[model samples]
Target: MKGLYLALAALLVAVNCEAKEPPTQVVYRFDDHRSLELKGWDCDGELWYTDTQKGIHSQVWSQFYRIFTKKFIHPSERYMAISSWGGGFTVSKDYGKTWSGAHYSPGENEPNGDNRPPYDDILSFTVVGDQGFLQTKHRLYMSSKPFDDPRILPGGPGIHYELEDGVKGDIQSGSAGWAWGLIYMTRQGLKGTIQELQTSWKDLPDKTPEVKGYTGWDHMRCDMDLGK
Candidate 1:
Protein backbone atom coordinates (compact mmCIF):
# COMPACT_ATOMS: atom_id res chain seq x y z
CA MET A 1 0.00 0.00 0.00
CA LYS A 2 2.82 2.37 0.84
CA GLY A 3 4.58 1.63 -2.44
CA LEU A 4 1.42 2.22 -4.41
CA TYR A 5 0.82 5.52 -2.66
CA LEU A 6 4.36 6.67 -3.44
CA ALA A 7 3.96 5.81 -7.13
CA LEU A 8 0.63 7.64 -7.32
CA ALA A 9 2.10 10.67 -5.53
CA ALA A 10 4.98 10.87 -7.99
CA LEU A 11 2.56 10.67 -10.93
CA LEU A 12 0.42 13.43 -9.51
CA VAL A 13 3.44 15.66 -9.00
CA ALA A 14 4.61 15.06 -12.54
CA VAL A 15 1.20 15.83 -13.93
CA ASN A 16 0.95 19.05 -11.97
CA CYS A 17 4.33 20.24 -13.11
CA GLU A 18 3.50 19.49 -16.73
CA ALA A 19 0.31 21.45 -16.41
CA LYS A 20 2.17 24.43 -15.03
CA GLU A 21 4.92 24.35 -17.61
CA PRO A 22 4.85 27.10 -20.23
CA PRO A 23 4.32 25.53 -23.62
CA THR A 24 6.96 25.88 -26.33
CA GLN A 25 4.62 28.09 -28.36
CA VAL A 26 4.36 30.50 -25.45
CA VAL A 27 8.11 30.63 -25.23
CA TYR A 28 8.23 31.80 -28.84
CA ARG A 29 5.13 33.99 -28.62
CA PHE A 30 6.23 36.15 -25.70
CA ASP A 31 9.46 37.10 -27.49
CA ASP A 32 8.08 40.51 -28.36
CA HIS A 33 10.66 43.26 -29.00
CA ARG A 34 8.33 45.72 -30.67
CA SER A 35 7.13 48.90 -28.98
CA LEU A 36 3.57 48.91 -30.31
CA GLU A 37 1.12 46.46 -28.83
CA LEU A 38 -2.05 45.00 -30.39
CA LYS A 39 -4.67 44.56 -27.72
CA GLY A 40 -8.36 44.33 -26.57
CA TRP A 41 -9.25 40.83 -27.70
CA ASP A 42 -9.68 37.99 -25.21
CA CYS A 43 -6.55 36.02 -26.14
CA ASP A 44 -4.82 38.00 -23.40
CA GLY A 45 -2.84 39.99 -26.00
CA GLU A 46 -0.89 36.82 -26.79
CA LEU A 47 -1.77 36.72 -30.50
CA TRP A 48 0.04 39.99 -31.23
CA TYR A 49 2.52 39.87 -28.37
CA THR A 50 3.60 36.25 -28.25
CA ASP A 51 4.28 33.35 -30.56
CA THR A 52 2.95 30.94 -27.96
CA GLN A 53 -0.49 29.42 -28.29
CA LYS A 54 -2.65 29.60 -25.17
CA GLY A 55 -2.04 25.99 -24.18
CA ILE A 56 -1.57 23.16 -26.67
CA HIS A 57 1.75 24.57 -27.79
CA SER A 58 4.50 22.67 -29.61
CA GLN A 59 8.01 22.90 -31.03
CA VAL A 60 6.52 22.83 -34.48
CA TRP A 61 2.85 23.62 -34.18
CA SER A 62 0.34 21.69 -36.26
CA GLN A 63 -1.40 23.34 -39.19
CA PHE A 64 -4.15 24.44 -36.84
CA TYR A 65 -1.62 26.01 -34.52
CA ARG A 66 0.46 27.40 -37.34
CA ILE A 67 -2.17 29.99 -38.30
CA PHE A 68 -3.77 30.15 -34.92
CA THR A 69 -3.10 33.83 -34.41
CA LYS A 70 -3.99 34.67 -37.97
CA LYS A 71 -7.24 32.80 -37.68
CA PHE A 72 -8.20 34.11 -34.29
CA ILE A 73 -7.29 37.67 -35.19
CA HIS A 74 -8.88 37.59 -38.68
CA PRO A 75 -7.67 41.16 -39.25
CA SER A 76 -7.94 42.23 -42.88
CA GLU A 77 -11.45 40.91 -43.24
CA ARG A 78 -12.81 43.14 -40.52
CA TYR A 79 -10.23 45.64 -39.33
CA MET A 80 -8.22 48.10 -41.38
CA ALA A 81 -4.55 48.72 -40.59
CA ILE A 82 -4.86 52.51 -40.65
CA SER A 83 -1.26 53.56 -40.57
CA SER A 84 0.72 56.48 -41.88
CA TRP A 85 3.38 53.99 -42.89
CA GLY A 86 3.93 50.26 -43.47
CA GLY A 87 4.23 48.07 -40.39
CA GLY A 88 1.89 48.10 -37.43
CA PHE A 89 -1.37 48.34 -39.27
CA THR A 90 -4.04 47.56 -36.65
CA VAL A 91 -7.33 46.90 -38.40
CA SER A 92 -10.62 46.36 -36.63
CA LYS A 93 -13.66 45.13 -38.48
CA ASP A 94 -15.54 45.20 -35.22
CA TYR A 95 -15.69 49.02 -35.03
CA GLY A 96 -13.11 49.83 -32.37
CA LYS A 97 -14.71 47.19 -30.24
CA THR A 98 -11.73 44.86 -30.78
CA TRP A 99 -8.56 44.99 -32.82
CA SER A 100 -7.68 42.57 -35.58
CA GLY A 101 -4.05 41.51 -35.39
CA ALA A 102 -3.69 40.46 -38.99
CA HIS A 103 -0.75 42.33 -40.45
CA TYR A 104 0.97 43.16 -43.78
CA SER A 105 4.62 42.74 -44.56
CA PRO A 106 6.36 44.96 -47.13
CA GLY A 107 7.32 41.68 -48.82
CA GLU A 108 10.51 41.05 -50.84
CA ASN A 109 10.20 43.69 -53.57
CA GLU A 110 9.42 47.10 -52.08
CA PRO A 111 11.19 50.45 -52.17
CA ASN A 112 12.63 50.05 -48.70
CA GLY A 113 11.60 46.41 -48.47
CA ASP A 114 13.18 44.75 -51.46
CA ASN A 115 14.84 41.76 -49.76
CA ARG A 116 15.43 44.34 -47.02
CA PRO A 117 12.20 45.70 -45.64
CA PRO A 118 12.07 49.52 -45.67
CA TYR A 119 14.45 49.70 -42.70
CA ASP A 120 13.57 46.54 -40.73
CA ASP A 121 11.74 49.33 -38.99
CA ILE A 122 8.66 47.29 -38.38
CA LEU A 123 6.54 48.71 -35.69
CA SER A 124 3.52 47.44 -34.24
CA PHE A 125 6.03 51.57 -35.71
CA THR A 126 5.95 53.16 -32.30
CA VAL A 127 9.38 54.26 -33.49
CA VAL A 128 7.81 56.65 -36.00
CA GLY A 129 4.08 56.81 -35.25
CA ASP A 130 3.84 60.23 -33.64
CA GLN A 131 1.04 62.76 -33.07
CA GLY A 132 1.50 65.77 -35.36
CA PHE A 133 -0.96 66.02 -38.24
CA LEU A 134 0.33 65.43 -41.80
CA GLN A 135 3.97 65.64 -40.84
CA THR A 136 5.81 64.33 -43.93
CA LYS A 137 9.25 63.52 -42.53
CA HIS A 138 7.64 61.27 -39.98
CA ARG A 139 5.70 59.81 -42.90
CA LEU A 140 7.04 56.53 -44.22
CA TYR A 141 6.66 54.94 -47.64
CA MET A 142 6.06 51.24 -47.80
CA SER A 143 3.28 49.92 -49.97
CA SER A 144 0.21 49.14 -47.87
CA LYS A 145 -1.71 45.87 -48.20
CA PRO A 146 -3.05 44.72 -51.61
CA PHE A 147 -0.52 47.11 -53.10
CA ASP A 148 2.63 45.50 -54.47
CA ASP A 149 4.63 48.66 -53.80
CA PRO A 150 5.02 50.72 -50.64
CA ARG A 151 2.95 53.87 -50.33
CA ILE A 152 3.73 57.13 -48.56
CA LEU A 153 1.47 58.96 -46.14
CA PRO A 154 1.87 62.50 -44.82
CA GLY A 155 2.96 62.37 -41.19
CA GLY A 156 6.08 62.53 -38.98
CA PRO A 157 9.55 60.97 -39.11
CA GLY A 158 8.24 57.75 -37.66
CA ILE A 159 5.30 55.98 -39.29
CA HIS A 160 1.72 55.99 -37.99
CA TYR A 161 -1.40 54.15 -39.14
CA GLU A 162 -4.91 55.54 -38.87
CA LEU A 163 -7.81 53.12 -38.43
CA GLU A 164 -11.08 54.65 -39.47
CA ASP A 165 -14.48 53.40 -40.48
CA GLY A 166 -14.80 51.54 -43.82
CA VAL A 167 -11.15 51.04 -44.67
CA LYS A 168 -10.58 47.33 -45.14
CA GLY A 169 -12.20 45.97 -41.99
CA ASP A 170 -15.62 47.31 -43.03
CA ILE A 171 -16.17 47.96 -39.35
CA GLN A 172 -18.75 50.62 -38.53
CA SER A 173 -17.26 51.99 -35.34
CA GLY A 174 -15.66 55.22 -34.17
CA SER A 175 -12.52 56.25 -32.30
CA ALA A 176 -14.71 58.30 -29.90
CA GLY A 177 -12.65 61.46 -29.40
CA TRP A 178 -9.25 59.87 -29.17
CA ALA A 179 -7.58 59.75 -32.56
CA TRP A 180 -5.96 56.38 -33.24
CA GLY A 181 -2.18 56.31 -33.81
CA LEU A 182 -1.05 59.49 -32.14
CA ILE A 183 2.38 59.00 -30.52
CA TYR A 184 3.61 61.43 -27.93
CA MET A 185 7.32 62.23 -27.88
CA THR A 186 8.84 61.25 -24.58
CA ARG A 187 12.20 60.73 -22.85
CA GLN A 188 12.04 57.13 -23.98
CA GLY A 189 12.00 58.49 -27.55
CA LEU A 190 9.21 58.37 -30.16
CA LYS A 191 6.34 55.96 -29.43
CA GLY A 192 2.99 55.09 -30.95
CA THR A 193 0.07 56.96 -29.42
CA ILE A 194 -2.96 54.80 -28.70
CA GLN A 195 -6.35 56.50 -28.49
CA GLU A 196 -9.87 55.46 -29.23
CA LEU A 197 -11.14 57.05 -32.47
CA GLN A 198 -14.70 58.34 -32.31
CA THR A 199 -16.95 56.00 -34.25
CA SER A 200 -20.24 57.19 -35.64
CA TRP A 201 -22.88 55.33 -37.57
CA LYS A 202 -23.07 58.40 -39.81
CA ASP A 203 -20.28 60.44 -41.31
CA LEU A 204 -19.02 63.38 -39.28
CA PRO A 205 -17.16 66.06 -41.15
CA ASP A 206 -14.14 67.79 -39.65
CA LYS A 207 -15.95 70.63 -37.90
CA THR A 208 -12.88 72.12 -36.32
CA PRO A 209 -9.20 71.71 -37.11
CA GLU A 210 -6.26 72.09 -34.78
CA VAL A 211 -2.47 71.74 -34.93
CA LYS A 212 -0.53 69.55 -32.56
CA GLY A 213 3.28 69.31 -32.18
CA TYR A 214 4.67 65.87 -32.91
CA THR A 215 8.08 64.44 -33.80
CA GLY A 216 9.19 64.34 -37.40
CA TRP A 217 11.65 62.48 -39.75
CA ASP A 218 14.30 64.77 -38.30
CA HIS A 219 14.36 61.87 -35.83
CA MET A 220 13.87 59.12 -38.45
CA ARG A 221 16.24 56.16 -38.40
CA CYS A 222 16.64 52.63 -39.64
CA ASP A 223 17.25 49.45 -37.68
CA MET A 224 21.03 48.91 -38.03
CA ASP A 225 20.56 45.14 -38.04
CA LEU A 226 18.12 45.25 -40.98
CA GLY A 227 20.07 47.95 -42.78
CA LYS A 228 17.98 49.95 -45.25
Candidate 2:
Protein backbone atom coordinates (compact mmCIF):
# COMPACT_ATOMS: atom_id res chain seq x y z
CA MET A 1 0.00 0.00 0.00
CA LYS A 2 2.83 2.37 0.76
CA GLY A 3 4.47 1.61 -2.63
CA LEU A 4 1.20 2.40 -4.44
CA TYR A 5 0.92 5.74 -2.58
CA LEU A 6 4.53 6.61 -3.42
CA ALA A 7 3.90 5.84 -7.13
CA LEU A 8 0.81 8.09 -7.22
CA ALA A 9 2.67 10.94 -5.49
CA ALA A 10 5.53 10.63 -8.00
CA LEU A 11 3.07 10.73 -10.90
CA LEU A 12 1.41 13.85 -9.43
CA VAL A 13 4.79 15.53 -9.07
CA ALA A 14 5.68 14.78 -12.65
CA VAL A 15 2.36 16.25 -13.87
CA ASN A 16 2.92 19.35 -11.78
CA CYS A 17 6.39 19.82 -13.20
CA GLU A 18 5.10 19.49 -16.74
CA ALA A 19 2.34 22.01 -16.08
CA LYS A 20 4.82 24.54 -14.68
CA GLU A 21 6.93 24.71 -17.84
CA PRO A 22 7.14 28.28 -19.12
CA PRO A 23 5.87 29.21 -22.57
CA THR A 24 8.36 29.80 -25.37
CA GLN A 25 8.48 33.18 -27.01
CA VAL A 26 8.58 33.65 -30.76
CA VAL A 27 11.61 35.78 -31.53
CA TYR A 28 12.74 37.25 -34.83
CA ARG A 29 16.46 37.97 -34.66
CA PHE A 30 17.92 40.42 -37.15
CA ASP A 31 21.35 39.57 -35.84
CA ASP A 32 23.04 38.51 -32.66
CA HIS A 33 22.37 41.92 -31.09
CA ARG A 34 18.82 42.74 -32.20
CA SER A 35 15.53 40.81 -32.11
CA LEU A 36 11.76 41.26 -32.01
CA GLU A 37 10.00 39.23 -29.37
CA LEU A 38 6.32 38.52 -29.78
CA LYS A 39 4.52 38.16 -26.49
CA GLY A 40 0.96 37.82 -27.71
CA TRP A 41 -1.07 37.96 -30.94
CA ASP A 42 -4.68 38.31 -29.99
CA CYS A 43 -6.70 41.54 -30.26
CA ASP A 44 -3.85 43.56 -28.82
CA GLY A 45 -0.98 41.58 -30.24
CA GLU A 46 1.87 42.47 -27.94
CA LEU A 47 5.10 43.10 -29.86
CA TRP A 48 8.46 43.88 -28.33
CA TYR A 49 12.00 44.47 -29.50
CA THR A 50 15.37 44.08 -27.83
CA ASP A 51 18.81 45.43 -28.72
CA THR A 52 21.19 43.57 -26.48
CA GLN A 53 24.15 45.68 -27.56
CA LYS A 54 22.29 48.89 -26.75
CA GLY A 55 20.71 47.46 -23.61
CA ILE A 56 17.28 48.51 -24.86
CA HIS A 57 14.15 46.47 -24.50
CA SER A 58 10.67 47.82 -25.19
CA GLN A 59 7.30 47.15 -26.73
CA VAL A 60 6.93 48.07 -30.40
CA TRP A 61 3.28 47.48 -31.29
CA SER A 62 0.02 46.04 -29.99
CA GLN A 63 -2.62 46.69 -32.63
CA PHE A 64 -5.76 44.78 -33.40
CA TYR A 65 -4.51 42.94 -36.50
CA ARG A 66 -1.30 41.12 -35.85
CA ILE A 67 -2.22 37.62 -36.79
CA PHE A 68 -1.28 38.22 -40.43
CA THR A 69 1.83 40.29 -39.86
CA LYS A 70 5.37 39.53 -41.02
CA LYS A 71 8.59 41.44 -40.48
CA PHE A 72 11.39 42.36 -42.90
CA ILE A 73 14.79 43.93 -42.39
CA HIS A 74 16.57 45.99 -45.00
CA PRO A 75 20.04 45.04 -46.08
CA SER A 76 21.29 48.28 -44.55
CA GLU A 77 19.94 47.04 -41.21
CA ARG A 78 18.82 50.59 -40.49
CA TYR A 79 15.30 50.08 -41.73
CA MET A 80 13.13 47.38 -40.19
CA ALA A 81 9.77 47.03 -41.88
CA ILE A 82 6.69 45.06 -40.87
CA SER A 83 3.80 44.16 -43.13
CA SER A 84 0.38 42.83 -42.21
CA TRP A 85 -2.08 41.96 -44.94
CA GLY A 86 -4.85 43.38 -42.79
CA GLY A 87 -3.01 45.96 -40.66
CA GLY A 88 -0.82 47.77 -43.25
CA PHE A 89 2.89 48.59 -42.85
CA THR A 90 5.18 49.84 -40.11
CA VAL A 91 8.80 50.89 -40.54
CA SER A 92 11.66 51.81 -38.25
CA LYS A 93 14.49 53.93 -39.63
CA ASP A 94 16.49 54.45 -36.48
CA TYR A 95 17.30 50.83 -35.77
CA GLY A 96 14.12 50.18 -33.81
CA LYS A 97 14.40 53.43 -31.85
CA THR A 98 11.22 54.87 -33.40
CA TRP A 99 8.54 53.60 -35.75
CA SER A 100 6.04 54.91 -38.34
CA GLY A 101 3.16 52.97 -39.76
CA ALA A 102 0.39 53.41 -42.35
CA HIS A 103 -2.40 51.29 -43.75
CA TYR A 104 -2.65 50.80 -47.52
CA SER A 105 -5.67 49.68 -49.47
CA PRO A 106 -5.08 47.62 -52.61
CA GLY A 107 -6.88 48.34 -55.90
CA GLU A 108 -7.54 51.79 -54.53
CA ASN A 109 -6.10 54.89 -56.19
CA GLU A 110 -3.37 56.88 -54.54
CA PRO A 111 -3.19 60.69 -54.37
CA ASN A 112 -0.93 60.61 -57.44
CA GLY A 113 -3.58 58.80 -59.48
CA ASP A 114 -3.91 55.42 -61.24
CA ASN A 115 -0.63 55.17 -63.17
CA ARG A 116 1.11 55.00 -59.82
CA PRO A 117 1.01 51.56 -58.32
CA PRO A 118 -0.73 51.13 -54.99
CA TYR A 119 1.51 50.88 -51.93
CA ASP A 120 0.18 47.41 -51.22
CA ASP A 121 1.17 46.10 -54.67
CA ILE A 122 4.36 44.75 -53.19
CA LEU A 123 5.20 41.90 -55.56
CA SER A 124 8.77 42.33 -54.38
CA PHE A 125 10.03 44.93 -51.91
CA THR A 126 13.78 45.40 -51.68
CA VAL A 127 15.92 48.05 -50.08
CA VAL A 128 19.42 49.06 -51.16
CA GLY A 129 21.20 51.72 -49.17
CA ASP A 130 18.69 54.53 -48.53
CA GLN A 131 16.73 53.72 -51.67
CA GLY A 132 13.77 51.36 -51.79
CA PHE A 133 13.01 49.20 -54.82
CA LEU A 134 9.45 47.95 -55.32
CA GLN A 135 8.64 45.96 -58.45
CA THR A 136 5.21 45.16 -59.82
CA LYS A 137 4.23 43.20 -62.90
CA HIS A 138 5.07 45.85 -65.56
CA ARG A 139 6.96 48.65 -63.80
CA LEU A 140 9.78 49.04 -61.28
CA TYR A 141 9.35 51.81 -58.72
CA MET A 142 11.86 53.62 -56.54
CA SER A 143 11.63 55.51 -53.31
CA SER A 144 14.38 58.07 -52.85
CA LYS A 145 13.95 57.44 -49.12
CA PRO A 146 11.82 54.31 -49.16
CA PHE A 147 9.22 52.25 -47.01
CA ASP A 148 7.38 55.56 -46.56
CA ASP A 149 6.41 57.32 -49.78
CA PRO A 150 8.07 55.69 -52.80
CA ARG A 151 7.80 57.22 -56.27
CA ILE A 152 7.77 55.43 -59.56
CA LEU A 153 11.03 55.10 -61.46
CA PRO A 154 11.41 55.50 -65.20
CA GLY A 155 11.00 52.07 -66.80
CA GLY A 156 8.45 49.72 -68.38
CA PRO A 157 8.01 46.11 -69.38
CA GLY A 158 10.05 44.14 -71.98
CA ILE A 159 13.63 44.66 -70.71
CA HIS A 160 15.87 42.52 -68.52
CA TYR A 161 18.13 44.09 -65.90
CA GLU A 162 21.37 43.42 -64.07
CA LEU A 163 21.67 43.20 -60.29
CA GLU A 164 24.39 44.77 -58.21
CA ASP A 165 25.85 41.28 -57.71
CA GLY A 166 26.54 41.07 -61.48
CA VAL A 167 23.74 38.58 -62.01
CA LYS A 168 21.83 39.58 -65.14
CA GLY A 169 18.20 38.76 -64.53
CA ASP A 170 14.64 39.56 -65.57
CA ILE A 171 11.60 40.64 -63.60
CA GLN A 172 10.34 38.03 -61.17
CA SER A 173 7.17 37.90 -59.14
CA GLY A 174 8.98 36.36 -56.22
CA SER A 175 12.23 37.74 -54.75
CA ALA A 176 14.37 40.37 -56.47
CA GLY A 177 18.11 41.04 -56.80
CA TRP A 178 19.62 41.97 -53.43
CA ALA A 179 23.39 42.32 -53.61
CA TRP A 180 25.94 44.81 -52.28
CA GLY A 181 23.02 46.74 -50.81
CA LEU A 182 21.30 47.29 -54.16
CA ILE A 183 18.39 45.67 -56.00
CA TYR A 184 17.44 45.50 -59.71
CA MET A 185 14.61 43.90 -61.64
CA THR A 186 13.22 44.18 -65.17
CA ARG A 187 11.58 42.17 -67.90
CA GLN A 188 14.38 42.85 -70.40
CA GLY A 189 17.86 42.60 -68.87
CA LEU A 190 19.94 45.80 -69.10
CA LYS A 191 23.40 46.49 -67.75
CA GLY A 192 24.62 49.60 -65.91
CA THR A 193 21.18 51.16 -66.04
CA ILE A 194 20.78 50.89 -62.30
CA GLN A 195 23.70 53.26 -61.90
CA GLU A 196 22.87 55.50 -64.84
CA LEU A 197 19.40 56.37 -63.59
CA GLN A 198 19.93 59.70 -61.85
CA THR A 199 18.48 60.04 -58.35
CA SER A 200 19.48 61.59 -55.03
CA TRP A 201 20.91 58.30 -53.77
CA LYS A 202 22.57 58.00 -50.39
CA ASP A 203 25.19 55.47 -49.38
CA LEU A 204 23.69 53.86 -46.32
CA PRO A 205 26.11 51.63 -44.43
CA ASP A 206 25.64 47.87 -44.55
CA LYS A 207 24.79 45.99 -41.35
CA THR A 208 23.93 42.55 -42.81
CA PRO A 209 20.21 42.11 -42.20
CA GLU A 210 18.85 38.61 -41.54
CA VAL A 211 15.30 37.10 -41.69
CA LYS A 212 15.80 33.44 -40.86
CA GLY A 213 14.25 33.83 -37.42
CA TYR A 214 10.66 34.33 -38.53
CA THR A 215 8.57 31.36 -37.38
CA GLY A 216 5.39 31.74 -39.43
CA TRP A 217 2.68 34.11 -40.62
CA ASP A 218 0.39 34.04 -37.59
CA HIS A 219 1.00 33.41 -33.92
CA MET A 220 -0.17 30.11 -32.59
CA ARG A 221 -2.13 29.87 -29.34
CA CYS A 222 0.84 28.29 -27.63
CA ASP A 223 3.19 31.12 -28.63
CA MET A 224 1.93 33.30 -25.78
CA ASP A 225 1.05 32.56 -22.16
CA LEU A 226 -2.26 34.34 -21.50
CA GLY A 227 -2.65 32.92 -18.03
CA LYS A 228 -1.10 34.72 -15.12
Model number with the top lDDT: 2
**How many collisions between residues are there in candidate 1?**
46
Q: Give each prediction's root-mean-square deviation over alpha carbons.
A: 17.4, 14.4
What C-alpha lDDT do the candidate models reach, one value each? Answer: 0.26, 0.45
Residue-wise C-alpha lDDT for candidate 2, range 113-160, written one tens digit per residue: 443454455455444454445455555544333431112222433236
Scored by Cα lDDT, where does model 2 land? 0.45
Worst 10 residues of 2 by lDDT: 178-187
- Indicate the TM-score of model 1: 0.24
| Candidate 2 collision pairs | 159-187, 159-188, 159-189, 160-187, 160-188, 160-189, 160-190, 161-189, 171-186
Instruction: Please state the error at residue 209 of candidate 2 in Å.
Output: 13
Candidate 2: misplaced stretches above 4 Å? 1-24, 41-44, 65-73, 103-128, 131-142, 146-228
**lDDT against true structure, model 1:** 0.26
Q: What TM-score fits each model?
A: 0.24, 0.43
